[model samples]
Target: MSELKTKPTLMEPKTFIDGLSDEKKRNDADALLTIMSDITQQKPTMWGDSLIGFGQYKYQYASGRKGEWFRVGFSPRKQNITLYIMNGFSQYQHLLERLGKHKTGKSCLYINKLSDIDVDVLKQMIALSFQARFDSEI
Candidate 1:
């Protein structure tokens, strides 16, 4: 198995956000940081280079892969905000219904802009996602 990488070492928000070339992406990252921190009740940390993460949990896959990762997190990618919800969409269909325009993958929700979605609903989704992670004991 590959050695698990530690979380990103960069801690300064300004430098981290400035590292993003797009102004809109930087702003989106800030907004997501606020939302995630509020819901997770944990300070934001720059995960890898681009993902702004809050709170963390360790997961051990049945395949014998194990690592530490944020319980809930988001990455302001070039095209959209990639929301990481480890539980996936099967359990959050109702919340997704209220989330406005978005797409889902195995563990990511993709949205082009925060303005295109409901802020309150997004917060609720984050809270619910975090709860689901805990409830599932993952």
Candidate 2:
């Protein structure tokens, strides 16, 4: 069976964040690090080359494919800050409504400008989602 492509690596999450070429992205990453760390009370780790992750969980698909993945994480991508909200956002619509300019996939929250979002609302969403995933509350 094919393995999961993005697994935890030895690279330091902060170093990766520091190496980002865009100043705004770098600053936004720092803010994200702080928010996620404060909520999870866990140090962030690098997942593959460009994704910073925190905590972890294991899951198996119906077909028996299984892997470990971060409980929550983000990637400062070229297009936007991509947040992996593992518990998904259905239960967080009220928070998303107040979150300012952003977009979402099934599990990814894409933010172009950190200044455009309500950080407190974002923090709440992160905390609730992390708790849901980490504690299996969902």
Candidate 3:
């Protein structure tokens, strides 16, 4: 089997955030780091070159694809701040409705800036995603 390319690294999260070229994106990333850290009660870790991951869990697919991944995370992409919501979005319609301006993929929540969203809702979503991973393991 091929190896996972996005494993955790020893790269410092703050250093990575500090190096972002866009000032607004860097500030948004900092806010996200604080919020996710508070919610997960874990220091963020660098996942590969970009993602700032909070906590981790092991996952195995029916097709035998398996790996460890973050419970919740985000990246300051050039176009948007992408949040890794680990659990898919099917269960959080209410929260999403109130999340303000954002987009999503299979497990990503994309936002242009922190000021555009209701941060409290974002925190709840992150906390829910973080807890769900542990809850499933029990």
Candidate 4:
């Protein structure tokens, strides 16, 4: 059997947040960092340079393509904040209705302006994602 492509690395969890350049983006990053951190009950890690990743898991496809990825993560991108939830939003359309301004793909939720969304709703979304992933695994 093939091994996982990448195992977790010992990156300084806090440094990733320190590297943000834009004050607003940096602050945004910090806010998200705290939310994701709390939801995952895990420290943040730098997945690449721009992504702040939380807990991780391993996956191997039927075809034997294997990889390791964080349970949840986000990137403070130039356009917007991109959240990486392992599951998609279709499962939680009701929550999205009250989540305020955002967009979604299969596994990504995009928020350009934080002020446009209810922070509490955002927290629930995070918690829902965390719980959904946990429960799905059982």
Best by lDDT: 3
**Model 4, 1-138: lDDT tens per residue?**
656444455666467666767778778888888888877798788776677777766666666666777778888898889988787777778888998999999989899867878888888877877766543331
Residue 44, candidate 3: C-alpha displacement in angstroms: 0.8
The TM-score measured for candidate 2 stands at 0.94
Question: Tens-digit lDDT track for model 1 on 22-116?
Answer: 88888888788777877889877777776667777877777778777777888878888899987778877888898899999998999999888
Alpha-carbon lDDT, every model: 0.79, 0.90, 0.90, 0.77
Which pairs clash inside model 4?
none
Q: Candidate 3 regions off by >4 Å?
A: 134-138
For model 3, name the residue pairs that clash.
Answer: none
lDDT of 1 at 24: 86
Better of 2 and 4 by TM-score: 2
Q: List the residue pairs that clash in candidate 1.
A: none
Residue range 33-136, candidate 3, lDDT tens digits? 99999899998999999999987888766667778888999999999999999887999999999999999999999999999999999999999998885433
